[model samples]
Target chain A: MRAAGKRFAGGRSHGDSRVDQFIEQIITGLSIGSILLLVAMGLSIIYGSMGIINLAHGEFVMLGAYTAWLLQSHFGLGLLASLVPIFIVVAAVGWIIERYVLSLLNNRPLDTILATWGVGIMLQQSVRLMVGSELRYVQMPPSLSDSTDVLGFSVSSYRVFLFFVAIALFAVTWLLMNRTTVGMKLRAIMQDRSVAASFGINAKRVYALTFAYGAGLAGLAGALVSPLKSVSPDMGTGYVVDAFMVVVLGGVQSLAGTVASAFFLGELSGAIAFLQNDTVAKAIVLLAIVVLIRFRPEGLFATRVRT
Target chain B: MSISRRTLMRNAAALGAFAGTGFPHIWIKNADLARAAAGEIKVGVLFSLTGTTAIIEESLNKATILAIEEINAAGGIKGSKIVPIVEDPASDPATFSEKARKLVVGDKCVSVFGSYTSASRKAVLPVFERQNNLYWYPTLYEGRECSKNVVYTGAVPNQQQDEFVPWLIKKFGKKFYLIGSNYIYPKEENNYCKKLLAKYGGEVVAEEYVPLGHSEFSSVINKIRSTQPNVIFSTVVGDSVVALHRQYRAAGLDPEKMPMASLTTSENEVAAMGGEAAAGHFTSAPYFQVHKSPENEKFVAAYRKRWGADKVTHFVSEACYFQTYLFKQAVEKLAASDITPPNIRDAVKGQETVAPQGRVRIEPENLHTWLWPKIAQAKSNGQFEILVEAKEWLKPLPYAAYPGQVCTEKGLVEKS
Candidate 1:
């Protein structure tokens, strides 16, 4: 025991004031919000376009994390380098699922929900069987692993990277949905599937592609967040609930609304955690969500659009 | 029931096939009983193979399998083979009870060995009692539980914190902070810690709990920094253990200044967090994979050989292994050849075994084990260097007395 004491340097408390701690919590909230934004963006697109909630969206995120883990371990790729493969692989899985199982059940809302839930379980169990149920770690790249002192607030460089990555993914997704002809077709289908089909929009193909793209975005979210936390099959379970909350609260039809709600919820929960305990913070957040939804059933920014 | 001519002819063909394959004549004779005989006994091995708790419970499952294999290889118990009927509870408490019931009722297992989380244990308690079956739980848990149908092979709070808290107070001062996952185990354990601290004239600076799997620890970490407690007594379980340790270190809080000690963190968690991440952290348990002893050495060698070189076993797994041998020894010692729930339960009372950790004895009174408590400091290699160990096995207590007798003695405590 004495020998062990020698190995440890005596603990000296860091000079962190209350104001600094508050700033740190804000940053933590923003980082968490960014993750929520990335995950919710995909959910918003899928729900808005198809009027079908993909409950297996979280499993897609789980797949992305596993893809990153596999690439990093097998190919010796950095966490950043593994992101592209993760997105592609997860998107491909999403495409196959959409083409096969989901396509047959299109327009059957209740069936879609239950089927996707089953799909989610299958995916989670499949991953657990493949990887073995143990927490796997991914290292933050050495350059991004250290903390950077910004305005007397010690900010983790990895979180800073995650914030920017979330933005970049959001921006790319925004451009893809707003500027592309495919985006136009998806929006057209969202408004009226029969009208869009009559107009030669190929609604089936558009819906499939849109769902796949949403899944890929979720995958991207998973890959980015994998380094900051332990990777496991069930890791996506927590994120999915948060993602759904963000999408619903933000207005499923509005991407900007989704972004806004994600940040709001994330920072709200984080800030509350600083003031109170985690359980209390979580309870208050849930209560707040319920009250808000009660008043604004169409969500904060829902247009009078059908979706 | 009338036997069909086709069924009789098929049975005859199967028997002829078995005879042609050179199966023993005894097997043919016992075909009507479906191979049930005095030479075979079935024990259920229940564990969470999937879900949240699988990280720890899976290790226990593997260890249980290894123990069964070892016992079977050692000429069986009085020439009677121990057949393990395995079931996956999937980490749900209700599922634990359901699967345990299935193991007993459906598979007809004489005894069941499993349950990592206390919730699961409690869930299956009624099932075991109803079925009149024995369930050997193999994990250190919050005390205040004792049952006739259950044999606890792991240390309770008394056996562990009795030695651990005093060591922390003696080495590090009385100012302590507490944190844990919001659950019965951590809540009860911390409640015990608080009483012990009060008795020892120590101050608890702060106590906090995060919901299970709440990965955001930045706020809590900030609280610990401001408080500057001498030690952070932690019972954070599951994946969050990795997050808290990583985030704590990442926040530049030196473990040397105020290290977090936990009853929950084990070798498996240390391995998950990486050696350097949780380095300087302390854990109190009856067993660590790196323990040095002839029994441990042989156990580790065999475990690694059977599992993998990369796989690491912790206290939970070790306790499960010990329970298997204890059951084997008890059953062999029984005058009767049949291994029933009542016979095994009675046989296990006061049964002693030189387990891998040390000599562990099951108390006839509470059904908990007399375990040797040890405190270990984690090294950067994901292995714990044993810092201190009990001079003798601490007696098991279902509801521990504050500042138990063994903890009152100082000379018996070793520094290194």
Candidate 2:
């Protein structure tokens, strides 16, 4: 009887270890999913408020990186300090692009996509021509570079900080969208442009603000990621494709859906990558997503219809 | 205000007669000669200026421009000015074929120097063959392809893997792990290495191929650690190389303990990987920045003067520059009435020159150059310090040194 009891105890411990590993993997997945969420939020906001896909959205992120690089290279600012000015500068550029180029094609989404694609090409080539196409490094703040022991796992402080930052940004974005008058106006414009104009909401002004805000978010994401990844002309290409996938997999107009889908895909990809080759893992994830879309039509977290 | 056709013709005739009479005879004669030579000596430069490989292409273009400028300053090739026409392949194979046709049929270039990817090279091969124009490909690629119309100036497997594998075995003894980006170059090269490793009594621990441009590599690194092989034979390229090396370091695997001997990691990739990340890694190539020679010194100095001091990569852009010189030397050797395509091809195959490396000869059978291979270790500053060199130039054997099944399946050989 004592031997059987000891055997039961051993089995319980093994089960506990498996549960702990599963939790750890979930945490890692959520951390990565948060980063993807931040990037996709920027993309979704721009696409939602203004019909422009902004193919140069990724380059705006690149600009943010370069801005941070320039700040450190020139002014000797720390990572956090440099991020502030990068946000401002990149936001200003976004405003200018919106006011000058994107506004010209208000109802023309296809033309806007093409124009922004051209803009992306020009931006990448200009960076290459000016900086000579070499990878530049951004200094990680020493505090964040170190790791902290959490539940017997060595989790990077930088990664934890990134999670908190993303959550904070998400909360702020939610407040801005739900509570503010500008947010209401922007949402109204998105729902029905003609009706919003009838209700005396300056759709143009709302678009400019939304564009700037979207770009600012992208800038922030770029500043956050520069430390993790090297800065180059082509640094953002990989993320752009994944961001598109996230936005589509989620509904194009649903922010909550975007977050949930990003997390879902991120966890799916991360877990599969752990088991199989990354390529095969991605293929499986994509296939699963396609199957889900065929069955569900909306998404995993489609909003309930009030009707 | 409307003039009749007869009146317009008469006025035009009078003006033409007056201008013809007033123009200098020397000027007129020079204009006529220029018109006669308007069919210029055309050379095409196909490079990826817009896509993922643009970084390498930019350096290659700068090197090519430097070569063209120097050649033009020396009164041009064969007394006719070398006209360079450039096209961007955008790193797309289909686009490469289209651009190659544009260069051959539309621009009518005599020879093309380009292609950084094996896919792009394969796409343009039929175009070059059909047009019967010369292509001086300047990037190290999969080594099974040999053609009369293509002068592959880059390193072959024998020049790189044959020497590197044997030397690594001598230093680190018979255990290996192969890691590479999932592409033709890595797949083909790793397969060849497997054959060679087996022949040499070496055991290949594990072979893992990740997708191209894959960023996250913890699992791959974990596999490497679990396998615990003596050395990693790597063929990853571009941004993935950066991610792999950085993750490898973060995972606490010291290259000093278990070194990675890579085929594709050059000084440029080292720079991308950062100095700290790339330090102590070993890479094998036919060229290095720290190669000791007066000619190399001169070439380095001139290159620095032309394109700032900070730009340096140890692959074969300098060799591309040397290829232009080789082409010029061949043209000078022929000294034909007109520098036509057939004559230029014959001249290139027959002529020999003392290159920056040493005396190089183009094998008439395959149209590839025979040159020495240099092994280099990645230094702290993203440059290579030459470690060992084949003192004599190894002949370009596009086929395996020994006749075997692998070589035969690929249809690569020197036909006597």
Candidate 3:
């Protein structure tokens, strides 16, 4: 293991005050976990509730990122201000894909994967052709641009905001899925689509809304992430893989599971990366997840409800 | 809007050279090559126009085309207009090989200029070597090979690091934190850097590599935070460059006291990260658009006039522009029929050009060029401020780190 905490008088830190690198690693892991939660929340929702392996979920993220870039560049809209509109715009695209494409191949989960993957490629190319492949940047809100001091170590306030936002989004999503009427209908459909349809529920409408919501969440993730990462067509591909891993390890249909798994993966990756290099940390994380999945097939927080 | 205006202007410029299938334009590059098949000399232009590498390679394509157009306008090489048969390899090595075959065997092109990554170069090397054709690679890369069929116009390891290490050590303190993307290129670069540090009596505080496309830098930043290295030698590339810079800034780490000296960060990356995030970092490169010279000014003006004012000319594009001239200078001696790979190769030895970077010439000893290496600091306007430029051209030593290993007119050999 790397040495724990050697004090160095550099950048904000100086003189006698010392912060444990171990504590800083925990914060780093939490930051990483929050990022994972931010990106994978949408994937968790769509895949968990709908049983749709949304390969185009990432494209939706890309689309939102492009939307964010366009808004900022064209209209001088800040990222925070543009979030709702970005969500709406990406949600509409998601609605169209579900209504026109996914609705047709409803019961066939495998074909949805192929079709969504194709859709993702189409979206990426469409953006590339229209926008051109130059790197576009998004500016962060002025307030969160500075770092916040936590236990003598500096953490980006934007990242701290992201952690809160992830929890907030998770809370909102969980409440929406449990306490609301839309949530009731969605759960009814998830339990038995035919029975839900037979009863007074508009199964088609609910599915479309759920998909749109999922896509919007992805859009929000992308919009938030745009400032940190360069906005390009292929940017979402990286997040999509990690999002998939989070969703799978979280137990596909469970929101709580998604949150838990995102945290688990993020902390694991962050702590290991601090000790070892990032590459080995990645391999180790993947290996750990594989072993976890092999033993606990239902994953971390699988819903126990049979019906 | 700035986007539409630039797009409209670029669309008009793209009108002549290559036809594109509508937006996210997968270019049908060979359509117009047939028009010049009769009078113009055929030269293949292989660059990835779409996919991940397109962000950089697209400029290279434009540079090559601009040079070709300039040559034709300036009465061409021996009055024979050069026509480029452009092909998009889509940033895949296998596709690069396939395109190379089609360009050399199918189109009967005299030469091809292409590739940014080493893998793509390696892929296309066999096709060029087997067919006895020439390939001009313009990207600075990890140098270990000496292909007789390829002419490297970019800086090798020594040309980039030899001056960079000592200058950084003298200016910034010597406790260096070596970080890069997990790849052979960064590893090779760090090896050379370590060698230089050892010679300079510098201390290495830490070494690390993150995966490509990685955007998280908090853990890495935490390490940098506590370790308090005097300098951060970074080769973390692609999307990671943007994240690392922004996060470093966000983490309140000042680049002034502990600056990031990079081989990977460039004008393109600065654009991606935005000037505020990128400013104060240093990059060791052979060329920067901010470099003042008559040749560079003219070149930039022409490039902007053709492409768009919004577009920035970078080191690779500069090399691409001059390497085309280097090709023209070599091919001027040959009769149109005498334009085989071997004859052109022999003629290209020591061919000189006053590039945007500075005076550059192909080394007769090796197929690589002698470059004027410079270190530049990123300013707040998405541009570089050229700081320290070499007094003279640094000879490209492909195997400078490995001492005895050298490339000559024949091939790679050990001289110790």
Candidate 4:
């Protein structure tokens, strides 16, 4: 009995070692997943309230990156200081897009998707023309650039900061959606736009604010990602595709579903990356989603609410 | 708005005649009249204007345009102004093939140039063969593919691998980690390198392949740190190269302890990676920033003047710019009465040009060029400081140097 106990203890140590390794992988996955969530949350909010896909949604992120780059290059503002004005400027741009362009496409889902796709192309090409289709440099501040030791694992400080930021944003977004009157109006409109209009809700104003809110989130995601990745005109396309997949996988109308899907997809992608090539990993994830759709028909956590 | 086909053909023929006489005024007038001409000298430029490969294509477009401008300035070929029609292709092979057909059949272009990816090139090969048009592919590709209708103006495996591998082995004593972007170019190149390294008694510590355009490299970088290789043989292309370099720096990996040698990364890539990101890296290519010849100096000066001083990098765009001049030299050598597609192809095959690198002679057998290789170190300012030149031009042995093909007569078989 003592011998068996000793063997079990040895096995437990080995299993504990593996658990430690898995924790590191999860951290990495969460870091990446958080970025996806920031981008997709904006996508979800716009689609949920306004009933538009906003294909150019990725461009908001691109613009934020460019804005950060321009600030650093021209004004010599450090990374942290640059983010301050970038948030406001990007948010303002988002508000303007909501007011002028997306507002007009309200109630026309197909037209909104096509129009936004066109706008995305135009925005991408305009950046291409201005900056010449090359990757721009976004220097990380020295303090955030280095890695920190976390229980014998080296984790990037920037990644940890990004996680905290995403969590804070998620909380604030939740409060805005659930606690505030505007939040109540948004939920009402998302539930039934015609019915909400009948109840004296200003659908137009709600849409504009919802769109702006989504765009602002995208802008924040872009700014956060700039230090981590190269800033290019076409950088947003890849992220946007992944974001769309996350949105669809999570049940587009459910914020909680979107968050769940982001972490699920992120961890799935990362774990597969460890086991196989990234392209193969992505293909497998996409295939898994396809198989899930065959069984579920309405995503993993989709609600049966009609728009 | 619809015009008759017969009228269009007649107007086209008249314009061709006017263009043939070297009368620009009459040709322009006739060109206006034959606005929908079917037999016009249609040339296709297939490039990636979007996606990951856009950086290389942007410069290639500029170089191609410069070449077209020079050709038209010199009264064009056989007095018929060369008309270049462009298509994006969007970095997709299916799109490349579709666009190739549109250029060959719909536009009736005799020849086309552009295609950075081997997949895109392979995609358009059947189209070119079916339509019997010429394709001048202008990027370094895996050797083994030899087509009758294709002219590969870029470096082959022997021109890049034979010189680069041996030099690296001699200099760094051959403990290599073969890291590359998971694609045909890197896979084939690494396969060839592994065999060559075996011949030299060198060890490849690890061989890793990452997906194209993957932004994160902490895991791969960690793997590299653990391996402790003498030198890293990298074939990572596009934006991923930047990510890898950034991770390497963040991990505090010493460049001297584990130097990197790359095949695809160049000055253009360095610029994208930024000076700090690319500092202390080494790459092997036929061209560098410090090519110090009178002709090269002139070329560099002219390039800097045209495109800003900050933008001139060792991009395929630079090669494409010179390729235009090379094409013109060949065209002038032919000086045929009717400078048609077949005539231009023959001219290009029959001639040689003194390029910025060295005297590049186009082999009639494979339609690839014989050129020199130069090793360069990435400076802090995103430019390559040319370290050593092979001096003499290395003969392009596309199939002969391939490991599997070395013993086969089929590999040595050349086109008649």
Best by TM-score: 3
- iRMSD for each candidate structure, in the order shown: 11.3, 11.5, 9.8, 8.8
Better of 1 and 3 by DockQ: 3
lDDT (C-alpha) at residue B72 in model 2: 82
Q: In candidate 2, what are the lDDT values of residues B127-226, reduced to their tens digit? A: 9888888888878777777665788788777778878898888888788988888888898888778878988888998877788878766556545644
Clashing pairs in 2: none
Q: Which numbered prediction scores highest in DockQ against the true structure?
A: 3
Across A195-219, the per-residue lDDT of candidate 1 in tens digits comes to 9899999988887898889899888
Q: Could you tell me which residue pairs clash in candidate 3?
A: A48-A253, A128-B24, A129-B23, A129-B24
Q: Which digits, one per residue and each the tens of the lDDT, describe model 3 over residues A1-307?
A: 1122223324343433334666677788888898899899999888888888799988888888899999999999999999999999999999999999999997356668668988999999999999898888899888999987666556789989999999999999989999999999999888888899899899899999999999999999999988877888888888899999998898877888888889889899998888787888999999998999889877877865323
Q: What tens-digit string does per-residue lDDT give for candidate 4 at B50-99?
A: 76678678677766776777677778755656688888887888778888
TM-score of chain B taken alone, candidate 4: 0.84
B327 Cα displacement, candidate 2 (Å): 1.3
Predicted candidate 1 versus true structure: per-residue lDDT over B1-416, tens digit per residue: 13344765776687578756752223122223322266787788999888898878888989999999998898888888889978888889877887887777766677899999899999999988897889999988887765778889887888779888988998988998999999888888888888899889888998888999988787787577557799999999988898888877666677887899999888888777777777999999999988988999988989999989988888999999989999998888775545678788888889999999999998887788999999999998889999998999998865664333222111112223
Q: Could you tell me which residue pairs clash in candidate 4?
A: B42-B109
Recovered native contacts in candidate 2, as a fraction?
0.20
TM-score of each: 0.88, 0.84, 0.93, 0.84
Better of 2 and 3 by DockQ: 3
**Top-scoring candidate (lDDT):** 3
Q: Given candidate 2, what's the lDDT at residue B54?
A: 74
Q: How well is each residue in A52-84 modelled by candidate 4, as lDDT tens digits? A: 878888898898888888888899987778876
CAPRI accuracy category, model 1 = acceptable
Q: Which parts of model 1 have CA positions greater than 4 angstroms off?
A: A1-18, A304-307, B1-36, B401-416
Error of 3 at A4 (Å): 14
lDDT value, residue A257 of candidate 3: 83
